[model samples]
Target: MRVFIGYVSLSGNTEKMAVNIKNRMMAVGCEVYMERLDTVEVDTLKDFDLSFIGLYTWDQEELPYEANEFYEELVQADPQGVKVALFGAGDWSQPRPCGAIDIVSNKMKSCGFAVYDRVLKIDQEAPAPDRIRQCEDFADRALSWGSKRKKWRFFIWNRMQNNPKYQRTAYLLRRALDDYPIK
Candidate 1:
């Protein structure tokens, strides 16, 4: 499956987590596209079968500046039907640790992305063995979701292609499906 990972990291904590997520997904035979949140276009979300968003919590439980912008753009980008998973890095000792992950996950849900509840939160800037395992588990679940969605899409496409009236719609859907083929 095709996956996209967009993340923001001020001190590389979130970046490290993002890399771990990428590696895990790649290990599962997924085609992953990793990009910094500041550089990624929100509209590109539609091109992937699954998405992982990672960020660090800023002051007052707010999203980091770049991630805040990315959130706004995501809300306006029509992300309906996209599959999403969230992760964040922060000091648990802080009053509001990993708050950005909650914020992004909720917003993505509100925008119609099929967001899962298994969010990964890392304490401090270091990765533990448990955290790495969590990342792998997260990848496995995301891959499973993508696989199911692909099957459903194929079912719908097959049905539509059988009806002459929906041939045009089926063709366009086929193109979109081509961009994110299931493995």
Candidate 2:
């Protein structure tokens, strides 16, 4: 059961949570690979059974510049049969958890990853005690779930190649996503 946590942090709040989550998952018996947002490449996820995404929400729930690049590459690869979780650290703006969760959750869902239940919400106040406990429980559940899920055991076959015209477009889009570095 290999799990990875990919995250982008500025003030270090989201990074702190990623570290804590990795510790918690390790305590619960899972091998966790954590990477800062910039260092991880898209191919790193080829074999991970479960992945967690962390971001620093800015101007609402949007990921900051660097994190956006990481996410774009990930979606470009179109991770097949991988379970994914999305989370972030942001202020208590108008909608709680809506900002990061909304954009990421939808995209991941569209990509066919199994979206898990625990949507963690935290702020400088660190959320309420119950919410913290909820997140802890979520970590335990996710780790256990990840440990048992079966790997796809084969390469992903993108059907888009069946049509040359569409394939060319998709190929160009993927290249664009890769070459476009995050500012």
Q: Kindly give the stretch of ten consecutive residues in candidate 1 with the minimal lDDT sum.
A: 150-159
Candidate 2 per-residue lDDT, tens place, 1-183, comes to: 577998888887777678777877776445789998688876676678788877767775566878676667656775666777766677875565537666777776776667776776567457546445655676777666555423311111133434575788757756786876322
Residue 59 local lDDT, model 2:
71
List candidate 2 segments past 4 Å from native: 96-98, 127-134, 149-183
The whole-model lDDT of each prediction reads 0.81, 0.68
Per-residue lDDT over 1-183 for candidate 1, one digit per residue giving the tens place of the 0 to 100 score: 678999999888788888888999776556889999899888888898888888999887988998767887876787766878888788888887898889888888888888977888889745568678877887777667666765655655666788899999878877888977644
In the predicted model 2, the residue pairs found to clash are: none
Q: lDDT for model 2, on a 0 to 1 scale?
A: 0.68
- Which prediction has the highest lDDT against the true structure? 1
Candidate achieving the largest TM-score: 1
